[model samples]
Target: MPDRKKIAVIVAGGSGLRMGSTIPKQFMEIGGKPVLHHTINAFRHAYPDIRIVLVIPEAHSAYIAPLLVSFDAPPSITIVHGGETRFHSVKNGLATITEPAVVFVHDGVRALISPELVRRCCEGALAKGNAIPAIEVKDSLREVDDEGNLAVDRSRFRIIQTPQTFLSEQLLPAFGQPYDPLFTDEASVAERFGAEIHLVEGEERNIKITRPLDLAIAEVLLATNK
Candidate 1:
């Protein structure tokens, strides 16, 4: 694995409408730094030499330089303009990978990703070809449909997280397939392309920052970790 390169395709294309902010949620401040700052930091913390491909909207490209400067981010980050959907954005990022390597597709807003979890995903992918981090569902669940809703077994389901790591041979070709709405994350894309999905233990604190409450939780977690 030492000879192989490690790359992270970070998707930060959210419009932030849900967060009710003019700035994209990924750029919003969290723990005295932007959400994306912490996200990229986590990967570097895990593997310093890992290459970064950051996908964001073309209009927001101007913000990247300043954000990087504010945190003194590494200059190795490759910035690409996002496409119409998550699937397309990821494909655009994947195009940057011309060689086979270990790739991680992550949500830029998930600022709480730890170095330990990132290493777990990397090791799993190296051994199994693909690794998706997930945790058990703790809340009650329901199956809703045209028929009345019914209780479903929460224990049977797991809540997925990132960075969804995979070998380049499997991950790059997976994105070459035609986009589908069901392609929610890298694991799904790889699975549809015939790669067996492997799950690794994920930290409960590795939560995506989507709302104000999530930011609060991140602050507390960051403080405690410090």
Candidate 2:
């Protein structure tokens, strides 16, 4: 294996509107720590020397240091102000990179991301050039149209998650294009950039904490893990 830098670009620009809290979802506490801290820790746990580029709303930047201090031992991080949209925020995060590396663009709210999954994504990306984590959709699906709603086959679909890993060469240039509403995630942006996406199994417990209920669930999961 070649010696390559591992970089994590974690985006957490949510306004906490969904969670109904003044604090951003990423800053919300779970297991006695901010969700964003857990996210950064997950990457570090996977690769202790991995570089972390955290993109957060400008308003929340001040709270970051205190949160890091809460860690057993704070790790150095490069913080960037988020952009107007998630796309722009991620673009800003990608701009911080200047070297050849394996980049994992992850959601800061997905605090439960496991070290195993982080390593898995890195390995898949290194072997195939890019790797996106996804899981089989378990719920029944419905298609709504002008006529009505119809049940669709859930087997053919997968729920995508992040820490979408890619080589910096492949991922960096993809964000160079003008922003589009269709660029929902790193995978979407890369797909539009003409890179074939490779999928790896994602953990079911790796849930994105978007609501109060999610925070509660995460607390339970964290306790169970311990």
Candidate 3:
């Protein structure tokens, strides 16, 4: 098989409003390092020579250079200004990539993504054109229908996570269409343009840290991993 370049787009545009912090949630410290540090490092560990693009708010871009230096960020890392919404932010990150390669779009606050999971996403994408990581929902789920609430079968629904990997050709054209409110994640955006994506088993430990309790839980998970 011909070698394909690997690119990772790490979105760090979170405002931290939910976490009750002045800074973005991805900048919060966990285990004496920024949460984004753990996330970027995971991709670097998985694909040592991969090119990485980080998208963050313009106001927060200045702080990232020093933070990246402190962590010795991947040699090919690039920092770009984010847009008004998640869709636009992702567009800006995608703009940095200009090759026919596989790309992984990941949330910066998801600091617990393991190297093995990273490889699984990229390799899956290589074979399937696109790959989305998802895990079975373990909790009971409910939904409000037109008439009233209903207990939905949790077994039928899965909790989706990142990094969502895709072949650049399959992804770029799909993103060419105008953004929609329902485009909550990369997989949705891809599917919005009629692209078929495969789902890979996501690791249970892979979680997005948004609330204060989530950061605490991530701290414990990090300790356990060590």
Candidate 4:
């Protein structure tokens, strides 16, 4: 049986500068609901008993609190103030989970993530100390330089995604170290502390909404899934 008390941390602290949006991408609408709302609903639908901690911009908590009712989200979800960086935001979210359980660190904009995927990630983390959802890079890889020049071998690269799952005990301690600007995700933090990560096949449809064009693609994906 899976750990019924598993916790999830949804990181949504980005300014959406890359997307060129005034609002954070997580707060943007997708298929008639906010992206973050869809992301949280996936976990809730997958594991009704699991606890959720949402990491949002400190300034947006008051704005988001009332919006929860619009999404019909559960009252069980707790909102934490996000830090300056994604790494720190995850750390803030992780700090709120207070149990011996498996935890999932998910990107709030990756709303296409399925409940089945979430369950698989949680199960993988429970069986292994750390787990990351990844898809084999089918396209030929290239390493680009600062001047957009190509370099090096691409054979070993794989595209990784979330929810990256980990044993709560194993993950919480890794966050205690000094923050590094280079840390991109939870897996990097765990790897820095010498934790072994097991990889599971990630769904191709599980794409992050980072650009304007992606929203149209996501709408099509949502329609197809329905």
Query: Which residue pairs in candidate 2 collide?
Result: none
User: By TM-score, how accurate is candidate 3?
Assistant: 0.96
**TM-score, each model?**
0.96, 0.97, 0.96, 0.91
Q: What is the lDDT of residue 35 in candidate 4?
A: 84
- Total clashing pairs for each candidate: 0, 0, 0, 0
RMSD of each: 1.3, 1.2, 1.4, 2.3
lDDT of 3: 0.89
The ten-residue window of minimal lDDT in model 4 covers 66-75
lDDT of 4 by residue, 1-226 (tens): 4544789898887666777888777888878877877888889899888888888888777658644875654448888998878888898998887778889999888999999999899878878887899987777666677778674465577799999999988899999989988688889898898898799878898898989888889989988894
Question: Against the true structure, whose lDDT is highest?
Answer: 2
Tell me the spans in candidate 1 whose CA falls farther than 4 Å from its real position: none
Q: In model 1, what are the clashing residue pairs, if there are any?
A: none
lDDT of every model, 2 decimals: 0.89, 0.92, 0.89, 0.84
TM-score, model 2 to reference: 0.97
